[model samples]
Target chain A: MELFTPDFGLIFWMFLSFAVLFFILWKFAWPAITKMIDQRAELIDKGVEYAQQARQDLDQAQAKAEEVMQEARRQQADILREADRVKTQIIEEARGEARQAAAKELDQAKLQIDQARKEAEQNIRDEVSAFALNIAQKVVRNQMSDTKAQTQLVDSLLDEIEKKN
Target chain B: MKRLTLIALLLISTLVSMSFPAAASTKGEDHGGEEKIDPKEIIFEHLGDRYGWEVPFCHHKSIPLPIIVFGSDGLHIFSSARVEHGKEYVDGGKIFRIAAEGDFKGKIVEIVDGEETRPFDISITKNVFALILTVIVVCLVLLPLRCYYRRKGYKAPRRWLGAVEALTAFIYDGVIKSTLKDKASKFAPYLLTVFYFIFVMNLMGLMVVFPGGANLTGNIAVTLVLAILTFLVTNIFGTKHYWKEIFWPDVPLWLKFPLPIMPIIEIFGVFTKPAALTVRLFANMMGGHMIVIVLTLLIFIFAQMGMAVAGGTAVISTMFSIFMLLIDVLVSFIQAYVFTMLSTIFISLAQENPHKEHGAAEAKH
Candidate 1:
């Protein structure tokens, strides 16, 4: 037997079936199916929108975290800078105090040295005056004993004093 | 305007020519002779022999069984048989001549002694009876189904509708909407009808073994008509965008330089696509059926060779037949889907709007 071939009979049946099928499908099937598909599409759209919103929220959270971290970093930097400034100021203050103390001690030592030097000079002057008085008394006794020798020595001493003045 | 006038003139001339009756060809006339003609032989003489178009693979044979037509004169019997290769044979080696008797009223016209005459008619073909039975079956099955769903106070079941809906949406969403965009919905009803019709016809093709072997979808004429319809729809609804994309595509300098040749090729492509769609579906369905027939024929061929070969060949043919049958079922459905999809795609392409988007975007810009 060869393969099948369509006759008028087959055509008629096919036509009848098609007509009935089209009518039934158009009336009942299309609406429900289209409605379901539409619903599915709506649900998908809503899901995508929700996902987008979630992404935006995540981005905002990330940005907020970054801002907080930057703020913390700034505060830490400021604290370190402030601590450095304070340390520099304290060191400068201490150096200034030390210099002032050193200067005051030097001045006191110089004043004490100047006072000792003046005392020593005054003692030497007193001794020289006492010795000169003893010498004069002795020379007067010798001049009475030996008038000629004393007159000659007194004249020589007077002539030398007159030349120096 | 010129072309239209010429076409109209040609059509009128053709009609006029058809109206002028020509002498009937003697090739169809039956002559009585002294030779005792077998009734079976006479029947086959009326029915034409099968002609194989694709040699050794595909063949087409149409048998016209004798039918009795009841006429006003009385009972007029008409032989549905045809002759081939100048030889008159009834059986034609393949088709069975079915006897029919019915009370059908019609005028009996016949030619005897080179003169027209009338006789009593009462014969119809079993083919006609089969056709009637098939129609009844379809009506009997489908009408009740329709009524049952209507009475349920609810829509038909989702799964049943789901298959249909999927096809509808696929055409609308995947093919039509993508191509036609705004105009797709308008053409949905027609596209849906085409899809379902093709699908059902294809399904019916699978039931060839049920009754008389009838593969409706495998017929080339039917497929050709469908192709013509698609061609008409596509051309009639063709938009500027369709033409622009085909004839004057935005190609680069080197390609665009051969403008005349390229445009002609592009135009040819337009015709070929729909042509391909038609031939592809028709050929696939026909080819699958042909293979099954060839495989079945192998058993007979092998039997003629030897008894041992016949036994082994029968077993192999049986297995092969089963395999082909399964494949044929799949091909039927796939071809139907391919046809529907291509039609929708073509229709949508024709209705597309090229500048609509650009215009809207320009406004925004």
Candidate 2:
């Protein structure tokens, strides 16, 4: 029974001692220890949060860069398509102009050839007439080297002229 | 591992055999019908509070402490050596003697003329000395820690500082943070003090080192005070909803209004919690100490019988004592953990918002 019994004086001393110890520790020891630990924990949490924010920022920048790159590619494709359209348009216009010029040149050449042929034919007709006239004169001269033929030709011409008159 | 085991086996067998011869030699000197060993006395003596620290395995006298007695007259102060192992001490009109074979047996009593009275003994007893030593040790350990933290600030703790820092962090993280949550920082200091105080006392009790063998935590009064403090801390800062949950729980109104049984039960629960805490710590430490002492006494009990019996039982009793001591070492740490863990839980429970929890439950339903 004595083994388990509690002494009043012992309890008092224990209480007083415990209270003193508790107060001393609570006031001094625990504050510094807990403060350091809390500061460290807060610092770590902040670091993790900063790292996560940085990662998110990097992802955003990467996505923005990708978007800009895509925009530039799209614009470049549009320019390339426009250039091809213009090239084809220019080529077609040039071909049409060349065809028109070629047709006009062909018409001019045909007209010139027709005029040259006509001139040559006229010249040939004049020469043939002149030659025929010379040949007739020669023949007349040769034949009318006989005056009678000449006189007869003239008289017949005169008689025909009188009859006509 | 194998070699170690073989060595241990050989050593044990040698000790066992050697004890037989030793017992035989002692037996030759013994007269017929030797008195039997009193295990109960030995165990009780080990567990009981003393005026001094007994240095085990030594023939020299125990280190005496101061004896302080507050009686009907006034305070009486003197060296415990004056009492001479509680035989008798006389000073003026006061008489002090060891009460034997009574309710106050093993206690120092005051004899006034013919009447016997127990003085209010607030002496520097073995347990008190140990507790004071523990406080000094705690301060010594924490002073260095406090300085290290002051110098280093937020840097990682190193060396002995690191070991202590780890223990502190473990308590903060495991007990305070887990239980107290938002209020963890507020209660951290108290929690740390409780943990270290209890743990140091328990470890000292197990080791039987300087201020170690004194079972301070095993004293019921000390534990009661500790529990009461926890009780006060919990109830004083208890939230409005904490009180509501106890008084008017989110149950049917009839239970609260008509019966009022729940509130009464809840009020009783408050005292029981701390009471349980007190008993749990005291019983565990006291029981562990008792078992170890009892196991040790078994060797002597057998030895008192005869040489053969003594030798045979020494090995078994010694083995049992060793085993019990090992368990005690583990128990000391465990009890410390349990006390701190429960304290944190109790304080946190008091701080809980019962209304919010009730609303959450209603939402779930």
Leading candidate by TM-score = 2
In Å, candidate 1's interface RMSD is 7.5
Q: lDDT values of the candidates? A: 0.55, 0.81
lDDT of 1 by residue, B1-365 (tens): 99996677556534432321111112112333323324433222212122211122112233444544333334433354432222322232222122221221112233344333433333333323333344445444334444544565334335644455455567557765665566765665456556655655556655544343344456554465567667877888888886876777656655656456667777897889777876787678667666666665565555445555665666566567667878887887678778877887777656657666454234224
Q: Which stretches of candidate 1 lie over 4 Å from their true place?
A: A1-165, B1-182, B210-212, B244-259, B356-365
Across B267-351, the per-residue lDDT of candidate 2 in tens digits comes to 9989999999999999999999888777666666666566677766776666776788888888888888899998888888788
Could you tell me the lDDT of residue B77 within candidate 2? 81
True-vs-predicted CA distance for residue A29, candidate 2, Å: 1.0
lDDT for B296 (candidate 1)? 55
Best by DockQ: 2
> Per-prediction TM-score, please?
0.46, 0.74
> Against the true structure, whose lDDT is highest?
2
lDDT (0-100) at residue A29 of candidate 2? 90
What residue pairs clash in candidate 2, if any at all? none
What is the TM-score (0 to 1) of candidate 2?
0.74
